[model samples]
Target: MSTDSTSLKLKKEIEEAADFLPLLGTDYIELYVGNAKQSALYYQAAWGFQPLAFSGLETGNKQSASYVLVQDKIRLVLTSPLKEGGPINRHIDKHGDGVKVVALWVDDARKSYQETVKRGARSYMEPKSIEDENGEVVLSGIHTYGETVHVFVERKNYHGAFMPGFKPWNPAYQPEGTGLKYIDHMVGNVGWNEMGKWCEFYAHVMGFAQLVSFDDKDISTDYTALMSKVMSNGNGRIKFPINEPAEGKKKSQIEEYIEFYNGAGVQHVALATDNIIETVKKLQQRGVEFLKVPSTYYDTVLDRVGQIDEDLEPLKELGILIDRDDEGYLLQLFTKPVLDRPTMFFEIIQRKGAKSFGKGNFKALFEAIEREQKLRGTL
Candidate 1:
């Protein structure tokens, strides 16, 4: 077959899949960390996440401590084991403050679990209900790539601070939000040649369709290369772009992640903001470090992305990257690794009608990452 015809056929087949287990939106992302209290404080002070709820010994029957933080529609749960030698502790030891749960808000947890489990998903948690004076919530989970799991949270009947066993955390140190709205998407880095396997899992088990795909030629620097595929559910509320290392002269970022993380894991969480310039200013003032591309990057950026709404001066000053797709353009910046290991980070993004990831900026972005890896002696 001719290459052009083959491309058209593949594009035609990449339509949205059927929605079996409807997902409302992201419920909360829970991270297994070493110290939930200190981490909570860090997020509050640095990222402007307000303390929303707390679960620990005070809540009674506690094996672990959890601090829930919220900013707009985004909710983050930081958890730490109160005692040693448990699964949480083991996860911490293995991954070192990485994401463990990507919870999806659903209307019926039982049906969600059953649909996925019957479709060949490995069960992580059986559907169970937890209740308090406020209401009741049903939660079910299934294992995904690495130690990470997707939890189906049915909270239509709950209305308390968070859920059962967590009280409202009204601390005096609530910082003003930085205009971060909600999770735009999350990226996962897998081992070599495993991206397609996990993409298939999302396709068959969760009813997600492949939105886009990138090869090594599309996302590569002078020394590193990787392949990626973007997957999205029926409603397009949740998007996951799975990445795997490709052959290159030096180590790619995916290789470095798997080496330090010891397995496949969540690479970064991209948070959406309405105002990129102001939000980046607040985050920088609050001491969140971001990757820097050369000033030369801005010299010809506009020539590539064409006219944008924001002034170029502040965006260049703040070191934010800009990319344009067929739909529209997006402004985004990547933070350095938030934890000790260079595993997980955050991507602050502002999409101005763009429905695609930043494919136009992949070369410059990967070059910046290669510089960081050189400093860490990992590349």
Candidate 2:
């Protein structure tokens, strides 16, 4: 099939998928960490996240402490258990510091929950309204792959710093942002052959469409391989690329992640930046480390992706990868795992009219990842 025809077909499918539920965008991503206070400090200093809200002992919540941080459209809630013997503690013990909830902003939380539940989604939380002096916010949730969840948030009637249980947090230490605009996409690493199952769940339960698919042939390095499918909603506001390990000479990154994370879970969050060069420079200055691909990879990148707006020297110097589709091209870089376990990481991406994931760069990207796995002695 021609590139134009393929793009058109994918666009039509995406448009058709939007009729199920009305999702505005990603509201916030909540991570259950071991220490909310120290993690908040690390995010504020290293990732340029500004303190937004807090919910804990002072707020009369004796169970757990939650810290909310915001950078542009991205809001991160880092929560830690105040008391022992709870789900939060168990999650921390099992998965370490990883994403527990992916909240979506919607028009009506109740209707969203009803439609999805009626479509076979397991109910995680029924629609519940919480109010404060600001107003009222309704929230509902459903379980997704692994223990990860999708929470529907209806906040049009609220005007608070965050939600009802949280108060505004203004600390003396404030930092500048890294030009990350919003979440581009999030990738999930499922178990051996669970990618197709979760893909069906998203398609039938949540009304998402498969935008693209990659076999082991497309994503394989010499030592490792994996299969993935990209699922997107109608408005294209949310995208999830689900991956599972494929048979290979050595352990693939997907297998390594599932083994360390103890099960299927989120692998990485891709953050979008308008100016990736500037944003990556600032992140590097703040002690962020990205995977290093061989410099030879850049020698033929422009030849494949064609001409781009930014110069190649800076991108190559900073170890960013480039790929092109029918629409345009994209620049992306992956960081090493931010936690002690080689589980979750971050992807910094800048889309230059490209709607597709970085298919053309998968081999090089996976080769770089394999190098990291080798260093950790996991491959």
Put down candidate 2 lDDT per residue, 1-379, tens digits, no spaces. 0011122222333665744776777999999999999999999998999999999999999999999999999999999999989999999999999999999988788999999999999999999999988888899999999999999988878888998999999999999998989999999999988999999998998888889999989989888999999998887888999999999999999999999999999999999999999999999999989999999998898889999998999999999999888998999999999999999999999999898889988888888888889899999
Error of 2 at 53 (Å): 0.3
What TM-score, over all chains together, does every model reach?
Answer: 0.96, 0.96
- Error in Å for residue 314 of model 1: 0.6
lDDT of 1 by residue, 123-204 (tens): 9999999999888989999999999999998887788989998999998998999999999999999998899899999999
Error of 2 at 264 (Å): 0.6
The alpha-carbon lDDT assigned to residue 24 of candidate 2 equals: 71
* Candidate 1 Cα errors over 4 Å, as ranges: 1-15
Q: 68 in model 2: Cα distance from truth in Å?
A: 0.4
